[model samples]
Target chain A: MAEEIEISISPTGQVTVRTIGIKGPKCVQAAEAVAKIIGQIESRELTSEYYEAEGHVSGQIEVRGRR
Target chain B: MSSVILVTPLIIANWSVISAAVLGACGAMGFTVASGAVSGSGRARSGSSVTRAEIEVENSEVLAGGGGTDEEMVVEKDGVRATFSRDARGALKVCMEGTGYSKGQLKQIGQELMEQVTQQYVYHRVVTELKERGMPIVHEEVEADRTVKIRVRNW
Candidate 1:
């Protein structure tokens, strides 16, 4: 799947950046740069999809039970 | 929603340094500067019971380097005139004067302008960071909702 980043800005100046279709650490890394520029990260919640194996990571079938 | 990171922007700066961003926002929002430019502290409107709104820029800096003891920018449009300046605490402050608009209406307008200034400012900063990291932009658009969407990827 193609990687995509979607950013939404609220009427009150809060910003939400979501990463889609990326795997493992790459997902967080992809969103981090943009996040840093937007403002202070008031809160963050990682989705279950975050634990999936990174598509580009070689020979890795990483997965973890829901926490 | 769990994959989302929420950020609250704190914008602060000296009026001199942020003049360009302010001007960019003004132009985008259909505001025009009556005078070319002015230095030191000044008010655009006098003796008006205009609604006042203030937005404090968090983690922002004065681009002018020198102290912002005396710097201001005035922008006007039809019924509105706005003054941008830095407070003693170094936070950028905007005051708007509009005769016909209600207090709530003026506050809403002020907030919208702040958002535009912020979005425009962050756009340049983010694009530069992307270029530095060698992540070329794949797609970008200003959605109908006025939200900017930018997609970048590493080749």
Candidate 2:
């Protein structure tokens, strides 16, 4: 999947940045890069996807049996 | 799918970058740069009949050098004149004046101009930094309410 960064700037000068297609700590890093350029980060929220392991698919569970 | 960040913009840039944003804002608001000198005729004509209003760009710091000095950029449109300068503390200050307009009107114009300056500043900073980091903008748009939305793809 292609990694993407989405940025929204309100008319009042507030900025909101979100990272798409990037998972784990790298996503935070991407967002931080943007924040550093613009200004100070007031708040940050990590989505559930951030906790997902890299390259891991959602709702997929593997069963292991003793061999 | 990772994180969302809310930011308050701080304009800490050299004169050229800040001037670029000022020009962008002026163009968007139908104002034209009148002079590059602080002593230029861009000021509101001095008279008892003129009303004046000043506004400060929040969280901003305009640096000197890079073709910038202790000068101000003046812009004018429709009998209204605005001067952009850095205050003693280095924050960006906008002083607006016009003969026929009231203080409220001038304030409104100054407020709008400041907002536009901020938007333009953020736009330039984000786009430039992203490009430097190898994430070029894939899509850009201005919404109906003047909000700017930018999307960049990381390869």
DockQ of each: 0.39, 0.69
Where model 1 places Cα greater than 4 Å from the true spot, the runs are: A2-12, A55-67, B12-17, B48-69
For all predictions in the order shown, the interface RMSD in Å is 2.5, 1.1
Cα RMSD (angstroms) for every candidate in the order listed: 6.2, 4.2
How do the residues B1-155 of candidate 1 rate in per-residue lDDT, one tens digit apiece? 22678777655444544777778888989998866555665554555666555655556655556534457677778787777677676666677778878867777777778778777766665677677877778888877877777776633
lDDT of 1 by residue, A22-63 (tens): 767777775665688666787776886688876565576879
Report how far residue B20 has shifted in candidate 2, in Å. 1.4
Poorly placed runs, candidate 2 (over 4 Å): A58-67, B39-44
Give the clashing residue pairs of candidate 1, or none: B10-B58, B11-B57, B11-B58, B12-B57
lDDT of 1 at B122: 65
Considering summed lDDT, which 10 consecutive residues are worst modelled in model 1 chain B?
B61-70
* Local error of candidate 1 at residue B6 (angstroms): 1.5
